[model samples]
Target: MDLELRHLKIIRAIAEAGSLTKAASVLGLAQPALSAQLKRVERMLGGRLFERGRHGVRPTPLGELVLHRTRVVLPAVTELQEEAVRFAHAFAGAPRFRLGGTHGPLLGGLVDRLATAHPGVPVTTYTSWSEREVAQGVGEGRLDFALIGTCGESPPPATDRLTWREVGTDPVFVMLAHDHPLAARRQISLADLAHASWTDVPGDGCFADCFAAACARAGFTPASVYETDTASCVHLVQVGRAVGLCRATFPPTPGLVTRPLAGAPLSWRHLIGWHPGAPSAGLATTVLGHAREAHAEAVARNTDYAAWLVGHPGFGPAHPAAV
Candidate 1:
């Protein structure tokens, strides 16, 4: 007595094919069976649905109207089913968390710590080259959290939707090849190397801004700089052509040593952020705590390196900690 999807489908096919026999064939049914189904639908709707001719068939005014309505209704019903399926599948699958960051050194050991602390919670990591992307990713649900450098103003994840905690702060140190003359000095200043050739990473990147800011603070603008985004900037320095600054969180390759500036206060602050809507699972909390500890450890180690530079045989004196 009630209309159903199969009845609506039959009507639509008949309207398109223009013949009962052809419409039945399209529906994978015999002509008689489809005709009976259509008649039942028409009776339920209180109207005749089609007109038969010697040659074929055509829809009546009532049939055309019903078919038009069904065309819109059926696809919406299908979409609802698919959307329900997508929800069930995504939520019912295994738990997965994604985190992104712009700082490589700070992220270096996090995976191991997370795996050890939350062995069951799968954490995926993504690297973003800029703070804008990191913040956007968290706000848009693409990432569960992000770690990045912050200057005077807070970095992106908008404060209304996201919150952050400072992990650690450390001075950005100029890394030079061991054989470079400044590399042998106890402490180097921006003035000491202002006129020297330098290797700079792309300015659009967060590190580049931090580096440029440090140079400006050091009373000089970086000039005659070779721009590179790869870690090879350190190797370029090793070859004795140019010097570059690397944060403590970056990998410590064989050929480079990081030294404090003679009397400069330039530092990069590391922060971790998460969305307000994101779940605070126990594992996430634990992983965040580990990241904070790891950051502190890196800062402490770099401080010891600075202390050694101050008293070392070749370098004359150590400068105050770059705050």
Candidate 2:
């Protein structure tokens, strides 16, 4: 009758799904079996964890407490599993160096630099939709290093096992059609776009949230008409349907024009993270130095951002030091 990892998992599943049937489906268990397990778990804990309702189930106060603890425990377990795999690979005499991040021009630049610096060290790369995922990969040891974006916020909870170095800051820009009236302006403000439709990636994370908050500060809620990737967003803009957010590091897309936001209402920090035990401090330093260089090149190529950087001296390194 003692609790185990499986019990914790079941608790988390039920709390997340908010219904026994849905939780059973997610866990690949029959409804009856899952219900029986839940009953056993409740008995062991000496309390009811959920209250069944017409809509679904709601966690009781005790259930919330258990779920909170399980959230912490589960990620630690995953990190341990990843570390075991890494150790096994090391013992097998062919340890792999892996890196992960969201897809961007800087990623290609960083990869090329790593290749030239390490010469023969084979590297594995993974891409995710969000910086959070890449940071998690580094923290869990699945990746030896990761480059991720943050809205000047603190790192996530799982990052306790990782060390981070800021690579650069990218000022956010608004991307519009070449002929759009706003495109004629050298710089635009969020308030000017209050009536414009926006196309953004579908996510409740920092990327979307930061833009939304900026819009709120500009005295209007954004009218998001489409949720899609950057290329699709550009297409939407090309058709005169919506405006999209862009980073200074983004390459120019055909039929699109980018302008820096006046006062830089939205910007994010680029960071490189790795486990404390990862390779060598020198390697991490080299990666960060290359990243800064890549960022400088990106800014130089972006005319609007380059102009903005001239007036804003402390945003990023004026001249990135040689790696």
Candidate 3:
């Protein structure tokens, strides 16, 4: 027996998620089928790939070896598929568009707009957490387009084949509990809360790094009294412990309110990235048109929402404060 794409995919999925059930869920396979396939791969490799445990399966040393190889092989396979697709489209004169986004409300909104506005084009939407993943998708031809938040500090690395452009900017906001003392104020600067304890998003890249960098630029390291990956960082403020920095477009959660960080120079920008060899005609334009419209709509909505919220009792004053 020889290792195949399906086996590689299963191995990679198991390694990433750390459990057969989760791998199965991601791969859309039945538990029994995935287990059997895993066993088959292990038998072919002549080693026990995974060790069954009380919590879940753990990759044995041998499993790690297979997974490492699979990671490399899988990307190559994806590239080959893209190459074949390019040739096929060239012959048929039909264009295919693949779009990627960083995960969150922005991705959802962009996808919604694309589906609604350009119903004729076949669109494949993809998302990942790390900038490396997004960069890889564009560089490897896995994605023709990417909507991402790229700060000036960490520009997407020099991929000779990809191009990036700034489409929109979302100002940073300080999210707090509705009843908090500063929540009732019209606008507050980074200086206003220099002495207050802060809560930070736990990750090291993307939005979390942006928040930390922004504070550092303000000339004071925010005293990180708490750091968590939970969705309800504002609730930490509601309990009177810590406050958090977030983008204005972050989805509104219960008991949390976000306001512009007065005098803070930092704001998250939405960037549109695409491959240099991307589709130039037909479906590509239709897809990009939707992406552009979606971005414009988000920009307009943010502006309108800022204007509407100014006078809406308990949010801010009756006039929109300059951001």
Q: Which structure among the candidates has the greatest TM-score?
A: 2
- Candidate ordering by lDDT (highest first): 2, 1, 3
Question: Candidate 1 has which clashing residue pairs, if any?
Answer: 105-249, 105-250, 185-315, 186-315
Clashes of 1: 4
Which residue segments of model 1 deviate by more than 4 Å? 1-92, 152-157, 203-219, 249-251, 280-284, 300-303, 306-323
Q: Tens digits of per-residue lDDT for model 3 on 5-37? A: 988888888888889999999999998999999
TM-score of each: 0.61, 0.80, 0.59
Evaluated at residue 74, the lDDT of candidate 2 is: 92
Clashes of each: 4, 0, 0
* Poorly placed runs, candidate 2 (over 4 Å): 1-4, 12-33, 41-76, 92-96, 154-157, 202-204, 280-282, 317-323
Relative to the true structure, candidate 3 reaches a TM of 0.59
| Models sorted by TM-score, best on top | 2, 1, 3
- The CA lDDT at 17 in model 3 is 82
**What is the C-alpha lDDT profile of model 2 across 64-87, one tens digit per residue?**
888888999998888688777656
Instruction: Tell me how candidate 1 scores on lDDT.
Output: 0.68
Show the lowest summed lDDT stretch of 10 residues, model 1: 314-323
Q: Model 3, which residues run further than 4 Å from truth?
A: 1-96, 120-122, 195-219, 225-241, 280-288, 300-305, 308-323
